[model samples]
Target: MDLRVSLQALMGRSLTRAAVAASVAAGLALTGACGGGGAGGDDSLTVGLLLPGGGASRFGQFDRPLIERKLKELCPHCPAAFAATPDPAVQRQQLESMITRGVDVLIIAAVDPELLRPSVEAAHRAGIPVVAYDRLAQGPIAGYVTFDGAKVGRLQGEGLLKAMGAKARGGQIVMMNGATTDPNADWFKRGALSVLKGKVKIGKSYDTVGWRPENAFVNMKGAVAALGAGNIDGVLAANDSLAGAAVSALNATEVRPLPPITGQDADLAAVRRIVRGDQYMTVYKPYKPAADAAVEMAIALGRGKSVESIATGTVDNATTKDIPAVLLPSVSVTVGNIKDTLVKDGMYTIAQICPPQLRSACDKAGLT
Candidate 1:
């Protein structure tokens, strides 16, 4: 059967609850059957899930599995093909490979959204619809799924400024942003700058490439060196990874009773650091809705159907026209409401965050 014809046939067959449950079971049962992501059953449609980094644990532990299961539910016979490459060029290569393998659709959370435009365009040329997942991809995309990045950045900046309190106007802040390649990184920086530009004196700024904690560490050291240890009152670290790096670098210097530091992702380590007063704030974008949205859109695209059913809005990429986009909101988490943002959302259990060492801190914060 030809690709489009086969996809049409699959779409014609409406999914039933029983069949979806069976498909979910089959997908979960046959884990390693697919190459890269998952590919096995003859009737199973393949979706290439391309994530940018291995450093962010959510992509693997949460996003990958959830997306796989949801797609399976949508198409009982289809299994997923998940591949996450750390290198952007390798990611482009993997995309081409998946297209060559006749995978029905492509879902990418690009390392470099703009840089991958050519690759995404290539996939569209092959008649494979591409969905920009998490990280916005700059090509003619069918769909996109991610939390509102600008809002996340604004929340981070506001949280930091609030923590700084009396010094909000006269304080000196160092800005350490995420990798330059990601559109999300730029949006994050833009949002933070909107709130921070008029509020504080930006002593120094650096864009941490690859979102690597090490790069953040190096950049942070430069900021402290340029601004002086005692003069810098706040630090805007884009995500939890960079925040941790910045904090570590800060401690190595004379800075003590750490200044307010902003972060996002609410990673386990970042939460712990927040408890310790090393980091003041972080943004929490719940992963479940995002995972579920990607799965739904991927299945529809795989079957050559409209993603309009699941999309919340439309977003335009540099090279792409209007693409269906789902923008989930992010919440700011502070020492005062860690339980509300993380615990209440079921993102983390108190047991996981409030270990024996953090038990007292959790109690003090009324986290228990």
Candidate 2:
């Protein structure tokens, strides 16, 4: 199938629970029967899952549950221990704690890859395989699963340029980027620059601290102060959180015409913002495939099997080279295609996105 079609299908409504359970039962049993160290006979196996906290809400709302459910379905007797915290130090401690508990395998979404390097290395030394999820943790990780970071940025950049229209030639845009500690942040910046550089004037740019909306708010306020709100024709916000902040700052200054803003994560609020014309676009990356890949990789590694079957490709990180990976695609969402994208994908229903106050806006956008 075409890549775009496949991505659309992946992002659409997930498989039913009954279907998933049936597949897991048959497939995993077959895997073990093939003598590839499948999940069978691993009654005492333990998997450690570490996430980067609930900042995005997707982690807790979708990824964690999907991963846990898949793990249980695939390996009926294997138990999983989960940990999530916003602080990098806390994440490191959690890694250490998991290590001390002697987990068979670990799936970690590091808050800061560099700071978590030592912990990952220690896990490697302890013979515990680590699967990097979302953000690639710098270490000898066995597998990695996430969406294409650069593609995500390119989508944002393209959306911003399109929204700017005739103003694109000399448009001034403020860039509200994610935390510098994230490797994906660097990739996103590079991809965005590939489209934005030379084409538009970057009035102000900031590396948002901690990926927090409040920090983005402060940074955006600083940008507006430095560039003058009128001078900024557009804003390139790395994610929904930053986009919301940029919009908030613009509102505070009471800019007559709100500049078009680009965002990612297709967050519920951001989608609502897009529908309301407060923001331009966002990138939607389905969580099911990513979480599902991580679970499969974790279980396979824990069973002393290779993840060659699950990994779609390989990626080289700062400390590791040619690591197995599965990089999913992302879709750009705009008001024009809200139904085709988010609603069709079942990411959100019309009712959820269109509250009573937004009813008119939803109808106007053909979302009703």
In the range 58-99, model 1's lDDT, one tens digit per residue, is: 677667777777766666566566567566766666666666
Model 1 — which ten-residue stretch has the worst lDDT?
1-10
Off by over 4 Å in 2: 1-41
lDDT by residue (tens digit), candidate 2, 1-368: 00111121222112112323332222211111212212234765678788886445778777888888888788767777777777787677777776766778889999999899999999999888999999988889998888888789999999999999998998899999999888888778888999999999998889988899999998888888888868899999999989999999899988859999999888899999998999999999888778888988988888789987777777777677778888888999999998998899788899999999999999999987
lDDT of each model, Cα atoms only? 0.76, 0.81
TM-score of each: 0.87, 0.88
Residue 212 displacement (Å), model 1: 1.0
For candidate 2, what's the RMSD? 8.6
For residue 41, model 1's alpha carbon misses the true position, in angstroms, by 12
Best by TM-score: 2
